[model samples]
Target: MDTLKRDVLSQRVQQVRPSGIRKFFDIINTMPNVISLGVGEPDFVTPEHIRQAGIESIQQGRTRYTSNSGILELREEIAALFQRLYGLTYDPLSQVLVTVGVSEGVDLAMRTIIDPGDEVIAPDPGYVAYEADIIFAGGVPVPVPTYAKYDFAVRAAEIEAAITPRTKMILLGNPNNPTGAVIPREELAAIAKLAIEHDLIVVSDEVYSQLVYGTEHVSIAAMPQMQERTIILDGFSKAYAMTGWRVGYVLAPEHILSAMLKVHQYAIMCAGTAAQEAALQALRHGDADVKRMHDDYARRGRMFVDGLNRIGLACSEPRGAFYAFPYVGNTGMSDEEFAEKLLFEEEVALVPGSSFGNAGKNYVRATYCTAYDKLEEALIRIERFVKKHA
Candidate 1:
């Protein structure tokens, strides 16, 4: 009898690890009475107005496939958003692409720009998917460490040190996922200068742009000469509490956008029609809802981060997004061991920082996306767990 080989998958697919975030949630779901500070998603539902818009679109039978680039109105709204927010202009017709989500936008961007053997310089302790997407695009991902000493902010000097002749692009998430560190404008300008000197494109994932606390979010694309080489990736997931909506957009130079659209057209055809309609309403009338959610996240984030630090985890106050990356080395356990033991003993779930990259080994990412009471309760359990382990 001939046995079939199980190793027939593409070598690239085999090389990458599965998403570290999802694997933790799978365990959290099977357990009862668990307090999760795990997943980075809003606790709020999509605003009523946005939901109604989606429902109305469906009722109106606006379910047909849109132009491969997405409907004109949504693209126009996106362009207007860039103009109003960053003072950067993009043509709605040729320079914007609507993707299924920032996830898809990232994939499209990688496929569009990366050539075989190209090197993409990304920040470590960053998003888990950045390296995987680069590898899948047949590019080498060079990780530059972002240390807690520097508030986990990616620095231009670190990026410049990591660059090589093969380096082709910079992939970064502002208001970063695990650490929730937003890069300052001065540092961002330094990075832009590096990109220009090296002639590299910048893939800026600003998905959490609207969730900053105390400071306004700045887009690197808005910097002088940057619009010509930066691809701005953003979406409604974080701002509008539309994680399930799967709608996001890319603002890029026309040449880059056209190349990405060719890939998007074949890969996804178009984002969901109803989701697009909902996104339109989100852009037009969802401002108040976004502000409301942002304010709540700020409150929860302060309370939760304060609680963690007081409990001996030494969490830094994150400036943006809703995560608290706390140093758990005091627990006398590795990141994975601390997370695992806490989950089993205290019924509390947190993601191990090592899941992000080597640079995250000493920390753990705790999201404040849950309700205030739940966060407080999780902090209590975490405190007990740390005391017991210590």
Candidate 2:
């Protein structure tokens, strides 16, 4: 028989790189007593009331598929959340679509707005999935470099420089990942101006909006005349400590939302029934839980960033989210080399900054979402490693 040639995966799938975060996670799985500061998940459990809602739903046989958009009550609560937090309004029936998670919302938004060859301008060193999501949807992701000197805030001028005639969207992760740099209100207004001038959509990922310390999270959509041009992706995963529950939502203009809904209906049908029920409870009664977790994260962030600086890693205090992206260049090693050597020698696991994007080259991301005691120990180990190397 002649030799057979089998090419099974699509070109897009072949082109996409596996998650850099997952690489360290895989290695940690094989090691004993590794202290992981890589994943961006909360150490807190889902609040008791939220868990009970899901349990009660299942107990009552409410486990069937929900409305294609999601359970109506959940959608209503989501709408109300935006109104309460940012004074943005949307009709739940026409403008809200619950998704599997913010991850799915990103995929759906890209698919809904991007035609082939369209361009999206996003911050470099952003969440790892942004580029891949655009690529999977056949759009080009144009990265605008953000620097640690400015605390990694994506400037409006930089974004305007990257925009072209083909640019269709501006993607933002406020209270950004890796760096945890929250864009200031004036900066967000400036970016909103550019979006309006370019007539481009803005996909604002505000998953960490409620977790900021010493600053308010300004939603770009809430800027004057910008809501119509913005798509908001947020959910219970971060604030409510409901990561495993896997429920999120999108708020967009009705027409754009309709298109996203069509794609979602085919791809997912609807979010999990019980999860939606749980999310409803989260929206309704999880304020106290969010505040408690946010306080914990705020304290941990201050202590961890202080530790990083004391250990000569040169990290700024993160204003939001749970990550501390510290410059490891002082240790005379590339980010990858630093991460690898630290993990092997000290059993402390963190993702290399280069994994996020080229802009993160000499940095490494260490999350403070683990227990405070564990973070303290990780800092001790890291300080020991840095002294030896630096």
lDDT values, one for every candidate: 0.92, 0.93
**How far is each candidate from the true structure, as Cα RMSD in Å?**
1.0, 1.1
Clashing pairs in 2: none
- Give per-residue lDDT, candidate 1, residue 75: 98
lDDT of 2 by residue, 1-390 (tens): 876598878888887899999999999999989999989889999999999999999999998988999999999998888899899999999999999999999999999999999999999899999999999999999999998889998899899899999999999999899899999998999999999988999999999999999988999999999999999999889989999999989999999999999999999999999999999998888888899999999888889999899888899768899999999887889999999999999999999998988999999999999899999999999999988886
lDDT of 1 at 85: 88
Give lDDT: candidate 2, residue 160. Answer: 88
For candidate 1, report its TM-score.
0.98
Residue-wise lDDT of candidate 1 within 1-390, one digit each (tens)? 988768678989988988778888999999989988899888899999999999999999999999999989999999999899888889999999999999999999999999989999998988988999999999999999998877899999999999999999999899898999999999999999999999999999999999999987899998888999999999999989999999999999999999999999889999999999999999999999999998999999889888888998887768888899999887789999998999999999999999999999979999898899999889889888878777
lDDT of residue 183 for candidate 2: 96
| Quality of model 2 by C-alpha lDDT | 0.93
Candidate 2 residue 179 C-alpha distance from true site, Å: 0.7
